[model samples]
Target chain A: MDYGDSPEEGAFRDRLRRWLTEDRSWSSASSTDDEYWTRQASWHTALFEAGFFALAWPKKWGGQELHHTFEVIVDEELARAGAPPKPSLGYLIQGISRFGSEELCDRFIPGLISGRDRWRQGFSEPDAGSDLASLQTTAVLDGDEYVIEGHKIWTSYSDVAEWCLLLARTDPDVPKHRGLSVFAIPMNQSGIEQRPLRMINGVSNEFGQVTFDGARVTAENLIGEPGQGWALAMTIVAFERQPAELGYVARYAKTVSELEGDVRSDPDSTRREIAEHIAWAHVQSEMLRLHVCRRLSERLDDPDGGVHGSIDKLLMTWTEQSVGQAARHAAGSATSQAGGDSRLGTYLYSRSQSVMGGTSQIQKNIIATRVLGLPSN
Target chain B: MDTRLSSEQQALVDVARRLTERLGPDGVVSLDDDDRVARLDQATTEAGWRRLRDDDGDGRPLASGVEAGIVASALGQALGDTALFGPLLAADLLRRVGIDAPGAFTVALVPELSSLAVADAGRLPAAVAVDALGATSALALLPDDGGFALAAVPIAGTERSFDLTRWVSSIPAGTELEEIAGSRTLTGDDILEVEAFALSLASADLVGIMRGALELTVDYAKSRQQFETPIGAFQAVQHLLAEAKTLLEGSISVSQHASWAVDALDAGEAREAAAVAKAYCARAAIEVCEVAVQVHGGYGNTWECMAHVYLRRALLSVSLFGDDGVQLAFLAARRMGV
Candidate 1:
């Protein structure tokens, strides 16, 4: 019933805030791609070394063995301090911890946690974007190894990552969902080619296309039993959608405040439109915060509560585009004027919000069929 | 923070549900008639429904915004009429300012009525509307320099409403209408809190209406058949009902948070949350009821069906304090720091 942090949580937040404020390693920007990734990996390693990497994971798995709320607090504090984002190794850690064998967890969990092995997602393909179960990626068993061959599109951080959690068809005769399996494969293997995919916002190489041509994965790399990739993928997707607790609410609040400040000072003709956008942004941000808290509480009561991550995704995307649009509108002629404000870039970037996690249309369908108990066609 | 209701709140909701069920779905059909209105008022008073918002010696209301919202929702689910909102609203306002309101009272913040019996004070200079149904007295709210100057005014005359269940009237201007002496006023933060409370309560009623309409339509769809199979089996009908359900759930989430904010958060936060709820629910109620009618087919358009009644109530409730656009503009003004 209470939204304020508990006394212990408050002290934990203060300690994290103090540490973040004292950290001097985040100052200078890297001049090159190689330098950028190197710094990112080092920063991630520093986070792990500082015992700030895993808040909700078990103690045996190199996590702090704290409550999930701590993770949310970490997220809030990090965002409030404008710290660098945590590396995308949660899926690797979760998949291995939850479903991977003991041998696999012992061999890979530490490496991933310590930032010695960075990971990327390899699920979506050209033909398997939303209909992910229909992926044509194949992984055939060859004695002790499974040889993987297929193309993975929209694979983020592939260039920077050393490995991937790959989904491939192991048994195509059964249903599309039942025929798949998950594998952790090294990205540096021979015949594994990665090409940069330019995004709509004109950000190049952030997303990539990786073609796995006879990329060999050992039998030990399989996350779960054969024909369990769909379920495993679903698990990973759920993890991916959970709010990155660090400062998501804070970030949105900051955006709204800045937007309000701009709109207050701007003498734009479209004042009402800008104001409406800012207002909606404020509402969505608050809703997002409440939803995260509610979901956290729900998870405590029922670990398998009905999935509302789609709704969260919908709201997040809507707020991003909304606030971004408002900022751009308020920036006025500066957008087209020489040395235009970066609001245009933000507006364009937010366009991918709905497209990234899951499309808005797909979220609506989930809301319609799954949440509403409606008959799905 | 927990969003689930506590056990006591759950019990109160169950009690409200039972009371609402006794009123029946046909209760609203008789609302326009004076005799039925009298009976409705008497029944509600006997049940002590109007006193829910009143405090219990500690200066704390017997039912917080959450409890009041839950009861309002129950009334809405039973297809109860708008006649209930005035009294519940008036009681809530009176309780906050330490004024003793009767079992049935209306609060005025808009002016005058139109021919179809709909209240139309859009063009009026004053911010006042009259609903004198089943009330011994009415509270008039006059905007006074960022706050409210309140006055207890006696019911003078009645105006027939398009919404028959709600007895509408017009308050006199200048020297004619007498403002009761020692009337309570809410200034500064208290005014904003009351405004937010009003929005939350009204939207809670809307959420109830939406839940009721969607449930009714779904039930009808399950049994009512066309071309041999039941209509619920059809994708068109199911999707229509499903969308309504989504809207209904969304409205409920926002409105529930609004109620919680009013009770738990600071005044400014409460106002913003309430504005969000009002903006969403004001339109969602109309859309949900409209779709309910669509799903009901020919029966939906008939006066005998509860669908039209829901639609009428939703339409009237939209402009009670402010409509969707108005609420949005209010939110926009706040965000713009104006």
Candidate 2:
């Protein structure tokens, strides 16, 4: 029934905020692929060393074993203090802890927890984006190893990561969900090359298509079971449904705080739009807290659950595109006349949030068929 | 984050189900007629339908009112009785706002109605629409900065088509209607929330009707023979029936989600969620009802069959609150930050 954090939780948030503000190692541009992989890995190691990354994870694996609410509190507090994003590796590590096997965890979690390395998601192929079932990546079993050969599009930060988290078909004759396996494949091996995929947003010199040709990785590298990759991929769908501006709390607060009164000023179309954006922002922030409530309830209800993650994913994508649109529309000439380094450039760059993760139409399809109970066809 | 209903909410669902079951499939059909309004009147007075709202003649709070919405959603999914929603929702909404609406009060449904015209100083609905209407008791007039104004003409002597579930009349051209009066100002988000509430309730009722049609056709398909095998066994009939099941389930989910969104309205997100749910539900209801007729074969074409009623209701329900386009526009506008 309580809508937000208790005093105890608030204090915990304050501690996280203080730490982030004080951490000289944390850089605003740390998430960019151009950043040195070794430096990012070292930073991630520091996070795990301090028990900042895996606080929500169980203690058996050198984690603080806190609840997701605590993790959420950390995220919010970090944002409050303008903390740089915890490396993608740190975020994806949670997915592994949720779905990876003991063997896989043993091989990866320690290094990941210690920030020795990171992994990229090799999910989409030429023909597979919304129709993920149509992915053509093939992984053939040879005694104890899966020799994978396929092209993965939109593998963000692949070149910067030590490994790629790949989804490949192992049993093509079965249904799509039953034919796929998830792997943490090391990318430095021969026959693996990542070619940058040029994007409309100019920020994607780091993201590219990765081709894995006869890339041999042991069965031990498989994160989940041979055919349970779909479930594992869906493990964090609820996380995707987070509110409008996620970890960008300090930035969002700064942007909207500067624009609030101008939006209310009379005699222009921008006023209504800006005011609406602020209103939307407030609503989105509250919904994020509500999302926290939904997340908190998961552990209490179904510790191991089956609710689809597509709904969350879809909502998150929508929120991202929306906030980006609001920023530009509210900023007027400042958004369009970009020359010197300004937020307008960054605002425009945020446009790919939907297309990068998954398109809006694809999200709707997921909601319609999987979440809303409509026939897929 | 915990959206799971408490055990008390769960019990309310159970109690509502028992009531729907005891009342049977024909329970909703009975409510469509003026004579059958007594069922809800008595039920609302008794223990089941108004568990939250009709307590000791005092109104339920907004949050409890939300629980009631969830109950209605479950009822629609289970029994397919779409007829009883209007009065229940109108009365419940009235209760949430602290308005002491009567047990059998009716609501305004004219599409052309607007609060600006109603609340304007000089203009008003005809006197006949206000007082001497056929059967409608109250109007949800719009209030501008001044007095509440009659939004609809509700013209009398227009030769009524359907009367029990709804009514028509005329009102004075410039009379000042009653304002909500109590100290409450609905925000834009609140407006969207109410719209979502109303639409979700209606769409749940639509689910009920769709289920009723599916049941009717399925029963026919089972017993009725075509050539040699029961029509139900044929692939053609099977596909149609299966499709109906998908549609019924689809509408059920949207309606369910929309209800949950409003019930747990931690913020204004319910508006878009509601719009999405309403748009999908509207499309599903039409699809299910249309296919229901096709599955029924020749008998479905006749007015003697109740399939036509489902068709009529489906078409009517699509544009009742707002059409698919209007709602999506509302949603997409907000989404695009326009």
lDDT of 1 by residue, B63-136 (tens): 67887788778877775543566676676666666666454467666542211111222121232344465665
lDDT of 2 at B198: 67
Candidate 2 residue runs with Cα over 4 Å from true position = A1-55, A62-103, A113-116, A123-151, A166-183, A189-191, A211-267, A271-299, A310-377, B17-41, B48-51, B54-63, B71-338
When summed lDDT is taken over every stretch of 10 residues in candidate 2 chain B, the lowest stretch is B126-135
For model 2, residues A201-253, the per-residue Cα lDDT tens digits are 44554578988899898888888677888876655333433331134333343
Worst 10 residues of 1 chain B by lDDT: B114-123
What is candidate 2's CA lDDT for residue B322? 76
What's the C-alpha lDDT at position B70 in model 1?
Answer: 87
Those runs of model 1 whose alpha carbons end farther than 4 Å from true positions after fitting are A16-54, A70-96, A106-116, A239-251, A267-270, A331-341, B26-43, B82-84, B101-103, B112-132, B142-149, B157-167, B175-185, B219-243, B293-305
Q: List model 2 lDDT by residue over B38-90, tens digit each.
A: 45335544754543443245443434543655555545434433233444544
Global fold similarity of model 2 (TM-score): 0.62
